[model samples]
Target chain A: MRDVYIIGAGIHPFGRHDLSGLEQGVAAARDALKDAGADWQDMQFAFGGSLAAGNADAMLPIMGLSTMQFINVANGCATGGSALLSGYWSIKSEEFDMGIVVGFDKHPRGAFNADPKASGLPQWYGDQGLMLTTQFFGMKIQRYKELYGISDETLGKVAEKAFQNGSLTPHAWRREPVDLDTIMNSQMVSDPLTKFMFCSPAEGGAALILASEEKMKQLGAKGVLMRGASVRTRPQGSFEVFSPSLDVERGGTPTEVASKAVYEMAGIGPEEIDIAQIQDTESGAEIMHMSENGFCADGDQEKLIQDGDTKIGGKLPINTDGGCLACGEPIGASGLRQVYENVIQLRGDAGDRQVPGNPRLGYTQVYGAPGLSACTILSAA
Target chain B: MAELLDKEEILKLEPLAEGLFRLDNGVPVLLGGKNKETGKIVFPMPSGAEAERFDVVPLKRTGKLWSWTVQRFRPKTPPYRGPGDDKNFQPYAVGYVELEDQVIVETRIMGDPDQTLKIGMEMELALEPFELGDEDKYVSTFAFKPVA
Candidate 1:
């Protein structure tokens, strides 16, 4: 296998947008190519994904009719991570010297409504109003809090920090800082979780240009080394979304599996990671993923958040760009947004929200429905 | 038994979906599927061609609340056939009830919204009116309530 580097990254601001999903995607792609000091024809291949947008390969006509392999990826919230991974593999395997990986999505306002029959679940599950993603997150955290003794205040703090960071992020959707009291007092969407703690379904696009070491040097472009990337699915007995039944015996989560594999692939432990961006679909998810990703022990988030350890300039900064909570989840684009934020952070170009002290290593994790998780590790080159 | 049927008839009762629950000696019992090879049990027993590989079995009526949440707003329709508007919709508790030595079934918890429910509390299966069906009958779905 060969080394892959991210020469450039770009993102269309996340939130409601007038442009179509494909147009947003193309804009990001063009910016990425420009940032890399390369042109559209320079990409030897492309990989992209979108949940609500049309096929990614369809961008060929709009992006100059270049005949390059463009594979479409669709892996729930891991769409962007998977696309990046595909591009990484193409370069690692020497199949392609350089390529573009992009993701974009525009969902209608409101909670995403899924078809039970399409997911192979009984229709009654949906009819009885039991098939909801919010309810699943609520129950999962409710149980975790009971077992781990996590406090409601800790949950509120997570959202408060997200908004605080979002205030500094130009690309973030929720740019205003929210107080802890306000977050805790917001309308209850599900028991123990309020409206302010949840990320709304919104629009956006992000793209990354990956190249081999040879290609990067040839273009005289600075780059970030793609150390590792891994995607894992739920194992049997693991609790996941949209389940009508759960096994009596609990099992490991996909985040745990993917995190473990990614650390091994990157040849580093979580402690060495200077800046991190794990999935924060809600406050509880960030708390849970903190332990799942091997950053901290279960129930330790309370102390970490209270001590401001996870905040910018702290020991281990997380979601310096506000994560899903502030950005609003665009499904396909959300994962790549993490990488884009990390790239800027690594380059020391994240204007106001930059993590103080030169950070060398950055990590990102994205998780979604049916219990899937994707993790990536990047290092400044 | 007759009183139960009278109450059902007054509401124009119908199961939300066929074969989910049935009356056994005047008591409603939820049906589950027991895998022939693995002995793994699943709720609402598999239907159609998939049903061929498992034996239909009655699930335990009593269990303990594993985890729960409340639906504070109306879910989107097409999948959700319940009350569409906020005026007609009432917040309801949803939970996973762990049946000892069997599967943990996701279910609606029948109770007052203001009443707080504790984890590991004993719960028992019951039938609740879900929504109005096409035939003017009230569709009944299975739910769990705190055991008296």
Candidate 2:
């Protein structure tokens, strides 16, 4: 396989928006192409990702319909990462020299209470209030705490960092810095996870332009080399959201499965990563994912938060972009939003939230509903 | 067996299948399937042979609370058809119950509010009214009650 590099990244600020999903996607795409110093015609292919929006490729008419291979994809919360993987492989396989990946979505306020029937689940599942994403996060964390001794304070610190980081991020939705006490005292959505710890289902768009090694040189564009791109689904027995039942014996969750292959593919270990952007749908999620993604050991989150190891000036700066906690999760866009932040950080373009010392390697992982995960590794080229 | 026959007129409610749960020899049990090949048991047998051939079995009536949380707000509708409207919405407990280390089933916990739920607490399955039905009858669904 040939090498693939990301030439440009762009995002529409995450939050409630009056613009149509298509318009938001179009804007992100436009910004990315402009940043890449390329024209719409230069894109050999386009892959669009969104959750509720139907056929993202429908935006072709507004995007200069160059008759490129356009495909629309939906992978729940990991939709953006899936689109990025598609574009990455397109260039790596030498099938297309360059491509565009865009993800956008709009959702109503309140908990993401999904219709069970839509996903082929029994309606009673939803009727029983078992379908709320908040419930899943709460349950997962509750179990994690039971086995690991994770404290509410540790969980609060995660949100505190996110809001603090979000305060510095212009594109983040919840830009006000929140204190640990504020997060802990916020109304409880589910036991363990307070309302403030949960990310709002938001509206936004993110886009990236990827080119083959030769194309990058041709355009004289310095880009972040794609070290690894992978997507995985839950194995039987792995506990996850929306599952009616789980196997008594645990198996590797999607994040663990996907990140293992990602590390192998990148020929590097988690110890080498300078920065990371992981799925933080809730503060506990970020804490659990830190261990699941192999960044740290299980039950290590307490010390990690207490010692400030994950903060910006710390050893492993995570979610420098404020993460889903601060940005509010615009499902389809959230995954790629992580990648965009990593790119900007590696490029030394991130202003206030930049990690100290020149970071070379970055990692990102996004988890989707009903069990799906995607990971991407990028490095300064 | 007696409760099943006595409540024959009361429907099982929408989305609650006819054979999902039943009283066997006076003991409530969830209908499940055990894979002969892998010895893996799944609640409500999954469709298709690729899921492995399984023998229908009655799951354990009692289990231990594996994990839990309380839904502080009522879920939106189109899928949720439980009791109470937005104005009168009441919080409810939800959790996964482990049935003897075989499988963990998601279930609604029936009990008093503000009652602390700890992991590994014993629990037993029970049939309760889910929604009111035609006439004086009502739809009954399964819920897990704390076993004292």
Candidate 3:
């Protein structure tokens, strides 16, 4: 099998750019090309993920930007990750020596138009008041409090941690300081999840350049080998309560199952990982990620956060790019945005938020499918 | 979309081609429809008992703020058509009730969206109209009432 590598990476901040969707994508794509020391003409194909099509009008971001070859994808919040998966496969399969994956979107003002007719929620209006991702995740936070006796103080502390880190990143949606009192008093967006606990919806774009080993050698790019990339969906569908893709009882989910399969195939373990990013659509999700990534027990992800191990200077830095928590939750751009953090860290470009002791192995995870999930593990050559 | 079948009709539908728990044993249950596209058999979320049964016991909730968020605008599905006569219900509390059985079900809350939500609070599910009604049919949906 060919060893594919990420040669280029670029991103705009996680808030609204006030630019057209295609313009945002083009800007990011140009940076990616420049970062890789490769030009747009050198890209063999392009895959784009944009959550809001209405904002962009006809001809997608990829079609507007790339002339050679293209495909566009949108899987709810997982669109960005899906784009990366497709680009990786294209280059790894020798269909293209180099592939460009771009994800960008300015979230619609309110709830995303999930076309409720398609989602099988038992709601009268599909998911009028109850379907926002924050509401569902808030349910999990409530459940955790019921079990662990986590204090409101603890949750505020978690919020403070994210904001403190967000302040460090110029691209974070929220860069202000949030103290324990500020987090506790913050307005509620969902139950148990204060506004601070929830990642804001922002307009943003991120791009990645993928190249086969031979292509990277020709270009002389310092790279992280795309060790393994895999995607999985719930056997039943996105809403099935019994999804193997998320947190199961004792073990990680089908998404974790897919990710573990990647690690097994690459002959690596989670302990070997140095830097990581997991999708945190909600604060509770970051907890689930620890156990899902073998960092903790299923309901015990909060302990990791509470203990400060999930912090920047702690063991195995995560979401070092402020995560989706600090970074805005741009549905189409989130997944690839996670991947961007890992690439920046691996290539040693991360400035203040950079993990100490120069990390080698990094992983990025995204969940979509109308709730399908994907994890991509990248490592230094 | 549920029909409260009369007791007699409920007994008569038994021995259906499907839905039989066991022929002459327990209640027969019918599962998913056949997937004509994939020529594959599929069964959606299945329930062994009905709300009326109330026998097997629902895992009760002690308490918890399962999660909460604002419904910034009206939904795009049934029950919500343009602005109804009364707009008092705009931006309502959207939440999930985490039953003791680890069951997480979505619901509307009894309080305001900006209210402080405590996790692990006792929660009970109640049926209500999905939104402001048209004075005709009521679309039944679940809502959570804190079990203080």
Instruction: Work out the TM-score per prediction.
Output: 0.97, 0.94, 0.75
Candidate 2 ranges with C-alpha deviation above 4 Å: B1-16, B45-52, B132-137
Residue-by-residue lDDT tens digits, candidate 3, A1-381: 577899999887777667876667767777788899997777788888787743322333444454677777866666787788888889877888987888888765544454444564332334234444444565556656667566666667666777777888877887876787877787665556677777767788889999998888899987778888877765432232312111112233556665786677568988888877887776766765666667666555556667788778888777887777788777777888888888888877788887888788998778754446778889876
Top-TM-score structure, candidate number: 1
Query: Distance (Å) between predicted and true CA of A329, model 1?
Result: 0.8
Q: What is the lDDT of residue B3 in candidate 2?
A: 40
CA displacement after TM-score superposition, residue A95 of candidate 3 (Å): 3.0
Task: Please identify which of the two predictions, 1 or 2, would achieve the higher DockQ against the true structure.
Answer: 1
**What are the Cα lDDT values of the candidates?**
0.91, 0.86, 0.64
- On a 0 to 100 scale, what is the lDDT of residue B38 in model 3? 35
RMSD for each model, in Å, please?
A: 2.0, 3.1, 7.8
lDDT of 1 by residue, A212-252 (tens): 99999999999999899999999888889999999888789
Worst 10 contiguous positions by lDDT, candidate 1 chain A = A122-131
lDDT of 3 by residue, B1-148 (tens): 1235432443443221122122123222212222334332222222343212222222332334454455544554442432343344456776544443234445567555566666556766443343234443333333566765
User: What's model 3's overall lDDT?
Assistant: 0.64
Residue pairs with backbone overlap in model 2: none
